[model samples]
Target: MLEMSNGSQHQTMKLSKNSWILILIFIILLLFFSILFFFRSKPEYVSKVDIALGTTVKVVVSSDKDPGLIIEAILREFHRIDRKFSVTDPKSVISQINKSENPVEVDEETAFVIERSIALARATEGAFDPALGNLITLWGFDRINDSAFKPTIPSDSQIEEALEKSGYENILLENDVVILNNSVKLDLGGIVKGYAIDRGLSIAKEMDPEATGYIDAGRDIGIIGPKFGGEYWAIAVQDPRGDSGEYIDLVYLKKGAIVTSGDYERFFMMDGVRYHHILNPKTGYPIRETISTTVISPDAMDADAFSTAAFVLGSEFSAVLLPVLGGQGLFVDAQNKATYTEGWSFFKEKH
Candidate 1:
């Protein structure tokens, strides 16, 4: 009688385990279907694209109200920033400051930009430099976008001369006045586009606080809000070695900025050697160690500047540096090896 009772208890336990396994399988299937349904029913968005800030600028938004006005306002803001900050535009304030030998008195906004740039330069120990205008000119990169641009390598002596005339130490600020010494020219190219993104998003938010979409200025994106007002957006990083649309990796984000600095952007090949525009201030030559650096940050200015700084400073240093600056970064070397900060994986979707 005892053996028979034990046999019946074992059968009961086996049946209970089977029942739970079936229930768990059903639950997972339900979740998978639910996700598909949610994505299929995502909210629609409207977008507009125009050329601004020396790159293709696109604005996308989904709001309860019409997004047309908001998009126009944002584009107008980009044009305004471009007008004020374009280093190539002789009429722009930056060009005027670069041309001026005396201390240039600037507005509060310009002063803030200069001060922030100097601060970032110090923070990165001269990795992200605005004082590279002279070096840029020596390489003729200042005219890279022009139709008549001719690619020629600068002599080592010329590079050395430009290096001597350039450094963050050339800048001195005194209560809304900017003084550039040692032939250093202020090129806010590193940080201006990010500032434009931030300002464009702010304009969208001011018009509608719950604006859902993103501002993509030449592929450096700043999220205005969550995708479809709830879901995360899968943002792709471009592969430096691949074609224009080819992607290297992807990171999912609901908010903030994703900015990339790659050697492929503005480059000229010379006798089988590709000469790109991302020059190291320290070496007065193009950086060869890093192929690209992408940064995710709460602010686009930080994202923009740090991406450039990381491209010059190498991937390992950014592992510690970016986190302290409220950023997560991915650094890809010339051999295509990738390095990520500790928090970078958290932004990626789990497989």
Candidate 2:
């Protein structure tokens, strides 16, 4: 009886040990699967950077699929527009138009750009003329960033000659054809950068409407959508005289575009004078009154053109004209005085 009882006890202890082993194995598997599921269900975001349109372009997106593919597609669009409107490329439409003596028939897109440019020039009272290609080339601003470029100052006669060729009236668009008179060389450098940003954003949205991103081309930013999903983007406007990355103000934007045109962006120090890329259509010289102009508009193109116009027209003039043109502006003059439009405070409000 004692031997039988001992055997039965030993069997019961073995079975109990096996049961605990099975339970521990099940717990380990449960934990492993839980961790795997947690990671698999999390959203993946990506960012990419490249050089396009003569600037550093960065695109960031949160996508359900491969984000790299979407970014490459958007970059391809930027290159396409850059190549199409390039002033230096002899094969580009702008170069062809500049070289031809007669009127050239352009695509509808080009015609629209020229027409809108003429209208902007008129509204700014020639402050933002698009027909200043000759002046731009004379100062070597067109190839200012080129490796082989040399800082050049045109003579008074040369400046006058270029100025004579600079006038928006010289350009006439008739039914998708452009007429360039007075030896006017066509250059759209002022607004093409912003247009490229807008194009990149459009491409990103088309590929994935629900995806959120922003395209930052040379610090002129266009929000593809809200940051992450519905967060506002904090954008800083750089101080024109301060060091690189030194900002003077902050603005919060959920959508739309912001552009800044500054004398410090492209300039050559000659005779202790800062001669920048932003030229005055009337004077045929670099604008001296305002050092920088920042514009926030619903459209990047408008912000681009208006910033240039306001930079040339000076701060007080832009204060009145910018609001009328459907944009809020911040202007810093050579004296370091800051000015703002009535609606400029709207950007500061993060609603």
Candidate 3:
């Protein structure tokens, strides 16, 4: 009887040990899945802001990991691209190409930008020309922020001479080589900011495919993925004739880009006349038909180019061009009447 009683107690002890082992395994599996779900279920958002490309650059990133590394990668790329394409920098590749008499070999980015600029110029029939560097210089916009900048309207002959050296046809690119006509210069100031924003957004996406983000490079903003679990981004349009903080419209977008070109952005007033930086290649003067133009497209670079082109072409032409480009636009005329394309109306909220 004593031996039997001892055997029964041993059996109970063994059973208890096996039960505890099973419970431990179950707890381990639960913790493992919980950790996995925490990372995979929802993403966290982090953002960074920096100044580059002569404008404010803001980036918002969503990821499970901290976004410091991603933001640094983006800003580094912006700085590199800015150095390669800046016309103001005498040592930049674009400046080198402009100064060289022979065909100049440039980086891939410069070549691509020049190619795209020329195509857009052709498409707009020279309404947006990047080869107007001479005209821009004659108008004193090239030396922006210069203390010696005396705002003087050039003589008719001077304007004509500057126009002589400016034409989209003067730029030729073969592979990585860019050849410009004599005395012709290239200024990418109008489009580089948008390109940089696109590049930054691409980098953020590469870092984390599931991440959502937006990069705003001054007047241009590039959005990747969706916001706050598939919500659209809100963009406000500046009122051209109103006070500084006044807005004319609001745009909601899930992805793609939005860019604006306005006389209010950069200009000098002399003798009660405004001389803006966006020069019409044909007229050698700022576009006056529209006070501001905004374009939304799948490509930020296209949006940037179109904004300037539409501003030059005015409301009638822009209304037509916007649809052809598979984009939408809002043009503000001198009368403060906002004209929206049919597609643009989709984004506009009803009053």
Best by lDDT: 1
lDDT of 1 by residue, 90-183 (tens): 9999999999999999999999888999999999889999889899888977788889999999999999999999998999999999999988
How well does candidate 2 match the true structure in TM-score terms? 0.89
Ranking by lDDT: 1, 2, 3
Candidate 1 CA-lDDT value: 0.90
Per-residue lDDT of 301-351 in model 3, one digit per residue for the tens?
Answer: 888888998998889888988789777999999888899888997776532
Give per-model TM-scores: 0.86, 0.89, 0.84
Which clashing pairs does model 1 show? Answer: none
List per-prediction Cα lDDT, in the order shown: 0.90, 0.87, 0.83
> In order, how many clashes per candidate?
0, 0, 0
Q: On residues 14-40, what C-alpha lDDT tens digit does candidate 2 reach at each position?
A: 346777888899999999999898877
Best by TM-score: 2
Candidate 3 Cα deviation (angstroms), residue 93: 0.4
- Model with the higher TM-score, candidate 1 or 3: 1
**How far is each candidate from the true structure, as Cα RMSD in Å?**
12.8, 4.8, 8.2
Assess the local accuracy of residue 279 in candidate 3 as a C-alpha lDDT between 0 and 100: 88
> Model 1 residue 101 lDDT?
96
Worst 10 residues of 2 by lDDT: 1-10
